[model samples]
Target: MTDRASIIAVLSALAIAAGGAALGTAGQVPQPAGDAPIIIAQATGAQATGPSAANTFNRLMKRPGSEPNIQPSKDGIHDPANPGTALLQWPSEAFAGFPRTNDGNRVDWVKTLAAGLIRPWTELEDPEAEPFLMDLTIVRQVKGSMPNVVYPHLEHTQWLDCTNCHDEIFVPEKGANQISMAGILLGQKCGICHGRVAFPISDCRRCHSQPKTAEELRQLSEKSSWAKQ
Candidate 1:
């Protein structure tokens, strides 16, 4: 095998092993300190580096989209390009199983699954649960054209307990943490989970869930000006 192919094979093996551990332990696999080993592999070409070398080795060992011949089905199963296969087995090819939205972008899996699979609060033990139904909109503009983000606790809570985030990665109070794309890229804030195990940060629209209309932008600007007073 060529060096690149060898590298990819090794990486794939690591990913499968890590995926197994994550599944066995209910997704509690340990994280690497400093830069994640995958970042190092992408940067330094997989040479040994410090104590993280073995951790990185184990971590690296542990750790796309688009187009024709792919179709999204309501049943969540797609006819694989290769016949006789059960399902598309790789994460890179997962988009083939979902429908596109009106704007022609792939549907966000979290939203799609949460809509179909999650039970409504009224069906749960406590219909009126404490910390009652709080959702937040992160309105900071990272760029002039980027959309504002809508974070729904409703979706996240279905899978993760509150202690997963509260007072640890994030404070419960609003505006307490200064979140930035730069910090996230370095594995801080949302980056702690995202880009590591969760959906990658590359899909900008996933978190930037709400695109603003021109009138809405104008109204938001007006509100900001008032808040500055």
Candidate 2:
């Protein structure tokens, strides 16, 4: 395989091994440091440096409406010569009226799903098949002062199957895996979908929804069982 493809395969394997360990098992994973700017620290021990690091992080936070849709002819991807391409609908028009976000095309997918505007089929061949939606939520405490992460299984499971994450991207057991911001930016763990197909981590509030309570902070510092987990 090519170098790029090989790298992807390895990351995919690691994600499967490490990610699944945080679901429901009694073990707990350590949290990474947080920051106002897009934190790019890696669990792999690589450090981000250089003066441009700040600018680079800011630039990576993509804003919606950066690329406007024009006639297919003028657009870069399509062949203007092809009449069929012109007939295709622009993404702006296609996604019109959908919920919006602060970044990345500005589409609020979770709200869109909750609104019942879209009903995606689970299986192409079996139209009768339905998605198995779970209502569980997993909370991961952050390492520093940032808000804790609230992972709602209902939101994700509504669209994906248990297998989509369980054995591959994340392990099903709790505290078995260690997740880091750096691993995610590299497309490991949650990065497999986030920042790529799903919402980008630039929207810090999206995942870091729960704020830390004073008691929680004390427990974390004291190295409580969950903290050591």
Candidate 3:
């Protein structure tokens, strides 16, 4: 009689569990507190519920304007179009009031001031006091259109040591290597320094100071041939 009672109790519990499962399948199950119902919309294929994380982030980050306002710097004031948005000005635009060259190019004030303030090679008593200085004029032009490039060795040596360029980049002997605009553009010879760390190659007149006449070009060619021999 005890075994019979145990079997009956197990059957009754199973029947109750089966009824609960049926109720759950038929949408009759009650949700626990703080639980949200997940309802996927068939039309949009999206959850028809509260704000998404991405939408919340956009609202917090973007200002109340159609266009984005970008400030130049931290200390700069917010743009008028978007009150909260800060914008920054370019270095050229910021210092537009400063002096420029005759051709309306920006003058390198640091280099210009250094040129004037620095001591002359003659004034220095020690041979090593000033860097081993010489000026090289590059006249290897295919056409006699542009001027010769005047390379100031003293200015470069002041900032850099001899080993920085000397047998590695350029041969120490004159006329040992041939430098051309094509090679320079391809990052050879002068291109290694210029347009990288040094002043850009855009300022043609800076190097090409002496514009040679047709006669000068002929004389230069003759001199070059003699040197080769």
Selected candidate, larger TM-score, 1 vs 3: 3
Q: Which of the two, 1 or 2, has more TM-score?
A: 2
Give the per-residue lDDT digits (tens) of candidate 1, residues 1-229: 2345557867976987898688773334355553444333332333445543434333323221223233343113564544645543443265455644432234454665655533345446786563334455445444444687777777576556778888899987767888988889899988997766666687678788667779877767777756578
Query: 96, model 2: CA deviation in Å?
Result: 1.5
Clashes of 3: 7
Candidate 1 segments whose C-alpha is farther than 4 A from its true place = 1-112, 115-145, 212-229
lDDT of model 1 at residue 123? 40
**What C-alpha lDDT, on a 0 to 100 scale, does residue 197 get in candidate 2?**
78
TM-score between candidate 1 and the true structure = 0.41
Error (Å) of candidate 2 at residue 168 is: 1.7
lDDT of 2 by residue, 28-141 (tens): 435433333434432433244644433444234422212443445655568888879878878777678888886665688889878977777789999768788899999997
Per-residue lDDT for 226 in model 3?
A: 62
